[model samples]
Target: MLTKDDVRGVSAMIPTPCKEGQGGWQYEDSVDLDETARMTEQLIAAGIGSIAANGTTGECAALTLEEKLAFTRTIIEVARGRVPVFAGITTLGTKETVRQMRKFRELGVEGGFVGLPLWQTPTITNSVKFYADLAEAVPEMALMVYANPLFFKSTFPVEFWEGVGKHCPTVVTCKYVGNLMDPKNMLIDLPASMDAAPHVQFLPIDFAAPMAYDLVGDRLKGMWSTSCAMGPEPVVALQRAIDAGDKARMGEIMHDLHGLPNAIPDFKEFSKYNVQVEKIRCNAAGYIKAGPCRAPYEDLPDDWRALTVASGKAWAELCARKYR
Candidate 1:
């Protein structure tokens, strides 16, 4: 079975640093990675041992195959084994994803990070088979399951994950980026993985992580922490409190954590607001290398950005201070 140390350090989802202009996602000749590298090095300096690129937050689905490879290669070069580099493979089909996994294995990937197989004809049963086929393709490397409900209609139940774990043990850790309420229910469903598979490492990765730390998480590994983006001080403080089992300090940190949701405006205009808030928060916390976002999903309207930044800065500042 994979232990927490094997897969449970903080992992940063790499943001594709976008330049505003004419075309969509066209990487101009050789990929320029200075911005991406800076973001990565910031995380490493902050104390995380590993990082992942091209996932949902990184907009993996939007990249072409060569572009994804170029993106992955940039991560590999900077990571350079300082920490294990995990790359996201977001193909819609098992065969294509399996082929991508094989390539990652050759590139010295520590494990494969696969988001749920959605945007396809899917059944929970078919989801189980999809993972099985991928595991069979790369017998040497382990796998990480990424759960994001935003993209597709398919949400695999805990039983589905248990079934996959039972069938293939190499799928070591599950990055459960689902609803915060999922833990209470999952505990009831998954009793134990059988001899055919290893115990699945359950990660409680609802974006509301520190808030869920005590309330909903008893058996979980911590989240795929976004708190890391705000610099190391607060995240490190929170992680230490969590590790020491210090409930008092944990509570203090989570106070800021609980308020994180307050940064967004309370309105139906959220899908656009979320990406905007996330980017501004990143900037306010001194984590981002660039300017306000580009278009379509571009910058928040002037009025909203001003209000959100004031709100975000306050909330983020509380973390840096309160976590201490």
Candidate 2:
């Protein structure tokens, strides 16, 4: 089984590929395994430490159980132990979540990030039990818990994390997507409180990684990057800057990356279209074929193609910069 430190470094979140349909909308067949496996190989070649498939970036909630397992197996098969591969085990049922993790473990995946079951946010006792049960069910597989306010309805206090860390030895990472301010406090205070859960590393979500890296420094060594899946070089370059403590280069890389999301006009309006944007970015970077997201997610905006291309080129240029 993988440990917390073993899973450190750049983990890319892959976007699911879909088959194009009439009116440019995506159909149920959008999950193309061959394309996904190809994308995973590309990220590994680009120096990503791990591959996180079926996460929110992969549109986890949108995929069926079979599709999720297929994605995990494809990643594992393509990766061939070159690096750790993680599947997102977020589903609506507790037993179902465990079932998926077991499947991933059976396929030889090292670990995965899991979110709470959908629709219902149980009390702290039940929540703690949920994680404990999950760990017990899949004792051999390492796990990361995703705590995002935007995605989850209830507040998961640090104490809850402490409980998970204490009880679930397999829980090695916590991807905290709550307020940016929260990590600051956790960085200062939570370590001692969470000592019982010694191996559980805390990380901010991908979008907030730059700020988190800047503030938390070495304590927060690894990150999960969505942009890196589409374009790993830029994100890897940024990580190198942070590791070397090159504030100037870090600033330069940030300058290049910080504005990328905004390149889409009315970004806030289409902000919820994350998987679609990632697909566009990945396609622009030549990692996969460009296509639309599945149902309920409308077609990519008119200007997204142009903006994604611009963003991809600019990012590639930044990646070429000398970090030494």
Candidate 3:
């Protein structure tokens, strides 16, 4: 099994490329494997530390199991061991999740990016047991806990981390998306979570990377970014700036990033349709061909669509000016 050290640097969460039809809503033959292959090569060439697919950005809930398998296979093959790959295996139940993780492990992925089972709110003990069961079943596969309070029921307090640390050794990292909007909550919660789970490295989202790096220093191994779908150059540069302790450069890059969401008409409302907004920006940026958002989550207002396009283009312009 891998350790926290094995999972480091700018970890990117990429959207799955959907085949074009019906104005970006396709139910059949949804995944565009050739485009996925090209996108994988682009990310690796851009110096991304790792690649993660089939998350919320990747439309995990909409993608069929066969589509996900083919998508993961394309990424693993194209990467060819250049960077570590973590594929999302989150499902509605533990048994199905285990079954999916086993498939990805056999495909030669380094680990699984998973969320807690979503049918009911999990208690602290069951939460610990959920991960413990996964580790016990697939001892060979490392785990990255997807700690998203927005989508899942659990808030994942420090006590939860304590239970995980005590019971689950195979959990090497967490995609720490909880309490991100409230820095006051983060200040108290993040470090406490770290203390409770010493072995698991916590990768905060790109917006919070600088604060997290300052808070924990070298112990903060890497960051998770959905913006990398626009282009990895800026995020990779941000990582480099953090590593060098160059606060000025970090600020410049973050300013550009922070502007992206502001370009949207209403960020809070836009956030509700995260999948569509992300795909629009990615296509607008023209970095990787992130075709379109898939079915059941593809609807977006015309006003939101226009602003998302501008936001993505703004990011592209920033990349060209600063990193390209």
Candidate 4:
């Protein structure tokens, strides 16, 4: 069984719920006792050992503070100590992030995965201070810095990360999710700074498993999964292969996993309809009872929902059989 410190183990980014017609995913107030319990159960059964709610994949940008509280509470309860829960501090600003980070710590969450504020609220110096100060504020829980290049202007260039790491020694990981395909993209120019980063983790959200395994695998603690979020069986198998030093097995698993990307159409191909497609697929996978999402991302048209669900159902069935 994977424990709290094994943060790199397969974890999920759950979808957020909001009130219908309010342009946000609604919370049914039933997630903790049932919905989350079910989701975590499925994930764990398939070898996943962690859960991260309220991240970008969960629509954290659209959630209210109250919703964040509710979501984290449910996730913690439902996980039932079976797997570590890393609460996402998806606050739009530094003050909110601090407050939420404190809140999750109080609730006994295992660790925190936070991103830099989206806009220009904190000066670069203040941003470093924010993380440094936050580390002091929550002395108990470990922290992981999320690197979402699309959301923040100052995501990278190693020097910045090294500076932030200096302030918060508890920050044990960096979720580097950009185009880290080429070794020089990250390691060559910033190897020294990255090596000296405060955290012990350097995880990437990449599907290019072979490239990552070959180039930067030695430096990373783990890899995040968007594709594997919905398909944990093979993902876990691949992860275990990587850990066991079974290069042949790792390549085989990677080939099977990446093939799905070719099958699932690009989000742009569906335009604004991609989210709807995603929800429908989630429903088909048994994570959600209904195919509902926030405005623009919710209530997908029936046609797209049907097609996506059909595909997802086939995939889920395949995974179930193979995993079982």
Residues 134-238 of candidate 1: C-alpha lDDT, one tens digit per residue? 778787767777755555455556567667866755677666555333434432332242222345555554344454455444444445655466564565666
Model 4 TM: 0.80
Instruction: Using TM-score, give the best candidate's number.
Output: 3
Q: Assess each prediction's global lDDT (C-alpha) against the native.
A: 0.61, 0.69, 0.85, 0.61
Name the regions of candidate 4 deviating beyond 4 angstroms: 1-5, 17-33, 121-126, 180-194, 261-277, 287-291, 299-311
TM-score of each: 0.80, 0.83, 0.94, 0.80
Of models 1 and 2, which has the larger TM-score?
Answer: 2
Instruction: Supply the global lDDT for candidate 4.
Output: 0.61
Superposed by TM-score, candidate 3 places the C-alpha of residue 67 at a distance from the truth, in angstroms, of: 0.4
> Candidate 4 lDDT, tens digit per residue, 227-306?
45456677677677766767898777666554442323443355355445655566676644432465435555566666
In candidate 2, stretches whose alpha carbon ends up further than 4 angstroms from where it belongs are 20-29, 180-196, 259-271, 299-324
3 or 4: which has the higher TM-score? Answer: 3
* Candidate 2 positional error at 279, Å: 2.6
- Provide the lowest-lDDT 10-residue window in model 3: 20-29
Clashing pairs in 1: 294-298
Q: Once all C-alphas are superposed, what RMSD does model 1 give against the true structure? A: 3.9
How do these models rank on lDDT, best leading?
3, 2, 4, 1
Scored by lDDT, model 3 comes in at 0.85
lDDT by residue for model 3 over 77-148, one digit each (tens)? 999988878898999999999999999999998889999997898899999999999999999998999998
